[model samples]
Target: MKLWGGRFLSKESKLMEDFNSSLSFDKKLYYEDIIGSIAHVKMLAKCNILTNEESKTIVNGLNSIMSDIKEGKLKIEGDYEDIHSFMEINLIKTVGEVGKKLHTARSRNDQVAVDMRLYSKYKALDVIDNLDIILGTIKILGNENAVIMPGYTHMQRAQVVTFKQHIMAYYSMLSRDKKRLTSAIEIMDENPLGCCALAGTTYDTDREFTTKELEFKKPVDNFMDGVSDRDYLLELLSAFSIIMMHFSRLSEELILWSTKEFNFIEISDEFSTGSSIMPQKRNPDAAELIRGKTGRVYGDLMSLLTTMKGIPLAYNKDMQEDKEPFFDAVDTVLKCIKIMNEMLGTLKIKKDNMHNAVKRGFLNATEAADYLVNKGMAFRDAHSVIGNIVITCEKKNKAIEELNLDELKSFSDLFEEDVYEFIDYENTISRGIKKEM
Candidate 1:
């Protein structure tokens, strides 16, 4: 029988089972679920809600179940309504009548709330650690590639920038994401377990003891508000969604960089795949997947935002819909963090092609203009003179430096022999590249 079946008269349809069964996805929170229950039982004994012997029986049975689960000896019974039901049902089976008293002061309403908060707390920290690994790899690459390449704008060489500068830009964004996760965790640190079924319970429960036992920072002030607040989960997914967007942009560049047209970087073969039809193709499969998965994480945030918009006060069954999105988002971001770190660690950058690109795009023309200005010409006149020089050089089918001083002098009397020295592509690039370091 289901845990709530004692009050119901008939079995739920198979359609209902398939629609409402969270056992499949939520089973992943088994560890967090058990931990919360153990804390709850301890609080029950401390508050005199359970006799000392009863508490001992319940706690011992839970400990055994935890061990069995760790050893993979216990099957997660699927017929129960959820993880709470499954644990309670298992507790009764293990320790007999006294095991049923484990749920004395709390309802599943508060139980699930605490479970989600605990799970999110643990999951968020795991993501933060992985983020540190990703940032470390980027820092290493940034330092190594500091003098390797210059920056670009509008797909044209605008200025020289080290590859290190580009990597550090991403590092700054990830630092912001880490700060966001830290803030969200602090907001969710309160315990909601003693809230029971929305209103404060009448039992002589010790909210302080449960909060301390669960490692929560404090008890929530309002019972109804505590069970209904999903803001913490929303904040976490929002932060994750933003990070996914950053990864997507990075993935797009990685895709372009690996192509024959760019030939700027070569992703490791292990993280890539060969095209079935093209014998010569080794595609960036993992980067492309990170780009593709961005939509799913974004959808998770949007789904929850819409769900919370129309809800009334206190808890509702609609809150059950919250888990799938939050769980999917956490899993998606965690995997991306791992794959991105590994890919960046092994990826190879081609310094030669990056440098070659600098020479083709008239990247140093602005330096030519500035050279005229430094020679006592007004910047407006210098700008016009540079335009004419470019047109003259283009007509002769030559680079800017290929023009003779007499030809340059025709555009402006200020053209001097020393102006040639300031006009090299490397000079312009060096000035532009200095900002990144």
Candidate 2:
């Protein structure tokens, strides 16, 4: 069953076989491996490396194996070195001697390169699809919850903003994330099937035919780089890390808003969990878990970066370390995206609580400054007058809007009846900066 057995006189020790085996994790790549092999065998026949009949038999065998694997009729297991070895062994078992010809003009080096590229492309699209769902949910939230809320700076209420504007901020962040994933997919579109080991093969293999069969943009230009390039994986992991980071920020806000202290929003019971000891606890476990998993995705990215940083040109055993990290990141990000969409879609907004919260904070002090500036006070002088008014209001335990016109005029004769309109919570949002679509 071993492809390289002809060169070795003795069987590899059981311990060494166990140490070298990757069938456990890499078997997940069976579908991609079969796809690339089908294309490779067809190209082999076109190049006259295999008879047409032999190519047909091998392709049929591969297709049967793929269907069996999908249907759970066949199981991929045992001491196979990798997915490539496991597949070649199974193909030989199915098609007899003709299956040996399937690997005649290729190597595991290029085979894995093509499989990973295909897998990454599929997962990137999955990420983008989930992002579309999240974007749609955000748009719904924005349209329904356009009421005013207090926006924060340094975790303290600093200005007035509409809920729609806050949600759209995340929409903008995720829009950029979608672009990054698309760029990563574009970078991985080339075929790496015919590079064979670290150099071009002497056999007359038709790389262009296989490239077209696999739907790659083109065959890779350099044999060594084809065997060695993993920048696409790195690029994707980087993009996934950033996507998770954005999700983590949103998760933090969700956790905060769901708290009794904030009471700004209420997560649906399905997405929340009760504390074991407390009768009155409904914790935001989903949001907390998404925030926690952000670090795991970050670790996956860093693990691959460190592994690839020291490896030399062309394929190396170190590159075998690439798959687990990449797979973990993809799975983690996709799950987080889906759960976040569900959590957000079902959550309830507390518009009254948000409005009352706005009243307590001196969120209108800036508008008061603008009121003074409109009365012909210098900008810096207006700022100072507002600051002094805020201090006096705090001493009397009142908001700037609570001060009467004669009391506000003690600081400056510029105070007017229209000053109340300038600091009104609803008016502040209407007068503040607006974002262009």
Candidate 3:
């Protein structure tokens, strides 16, 4: 029977059952759903709504069900409609009629509210730990490569830098994402259990009792807002979207670095794939997937925002749409982070290739101009002199440092013999490497 079948005269159609059922995805929250029930039963016992013996029976039944679930013995059934109903019906089967008494002072509205909050809380913690692993891997890679690389702007070499510095930039982005997850978790910590239906229940229930039992920071103050608010889900989606953007950017860099034209890095065999048709191909598939998943996380955020915008307040059925997107965003980000951390940990960096790229891009010209300006030449004149020198080098197809002193002097009298010292590839790399820090 449906949980609310007493009020409805007719059976729901198959189409309606298919549309209303959330058991497939929500079954993942089974542990949390049972935990919420245990907390609720204790509160009922305290309020005289359920006897102490009944509360003991419900808690024991919930614990046994949890054990069965962990052992893979419990199957979530479609006939139960949703996770809440499925767990409740199974509890009754295990603990007899007393299981029905567990819902004495509550409604499904608050039940789902608490379940989602608990699930989100733990998922955010998992994501934060995953980010920590990625961050630690990046820090190690950055420290190891801090002495070799050429940084670029507008897809052209702008300066010389260390691979470590490049990796640290992504580390900083991940750190900010961790902070966003932390803040979102803080906002989800409030308890929504006492707000039965859309108003405070008349059962003289001790909300504080359930709050303590569930380890919630405190009871939600407004009854209607408790069950109705999905701001926590929105906050989480927004955080996940930003994290996805970070992953996209990091993956984009990894993709570019892995290309032969750049050859700044290489993916390990375990992290890359060999083409079926090309024996020579080693593709950065993990990086590509991270880039692709960004679109999915973005879609989840936008879709949920749309679902929320047109709805009236105080708990509408439309709010049922919130869980799928929030769940999807969480799952997507977790997968991206997991793969990214592994890819980062195993990737092989080509410091020699990075050094070689500096040669092709004439990365030392700006540092040469800075050398002239520091030697008391006016900044504009120094720039003009360097600009002409670059043009001369381009025409002659030589690097700035390769030009004979006389050939450079032909462009500007500012070109002294010692100016070659400033235009050395190592000096350019020093500037690039320092800029990252």
lDDT of 3 by residue, 356-386 (tens): 7777667777788888887788889888888
* Best TM-score among the predictions, by candidate number: 2
C-alpha TM-score for every candidate: 0.92, 0.97, 0.94
Off by over 4 Å in 2: 433-437
Better model by TM-score: candidate 1 vs candidate 2? 2
After TM-score superposition, the amount by which residue 84's alpha carbon in candidate 1 deviates from its true location, in angstroms, is 0.7
* Candidate 2 C-alpha lDDT tens digits along 1-437: 68888989999998988888888988889999999999998888888888899999999999999999999998898768998988888889998987888888799999999999999999999999999999999999989998788899999889888888899899999999999999888878999998999987999888889889988889899999999979999999999999999999999998998888999899999899998899899989999999999999999999999998988887998898999999999999999999999999998999988878888779888888988888899989999998998889889999998999899999999998999987898877876644344
User: Which number leads on lDDT?
Assistant: 2
Ranking by TM-score, best first? 2, 3, 1
- Residue pairs that clash (backbone atoms under 3 angstroms), model 3: 142-164, 145-164, 160-429, 160-432, 161-433
TM-score of decoy 2? 0.97
Top-down lDDT ranking:
2, 1, 3
All candidates' lDDT scores?
A: 0.85, 0.91, 0.85
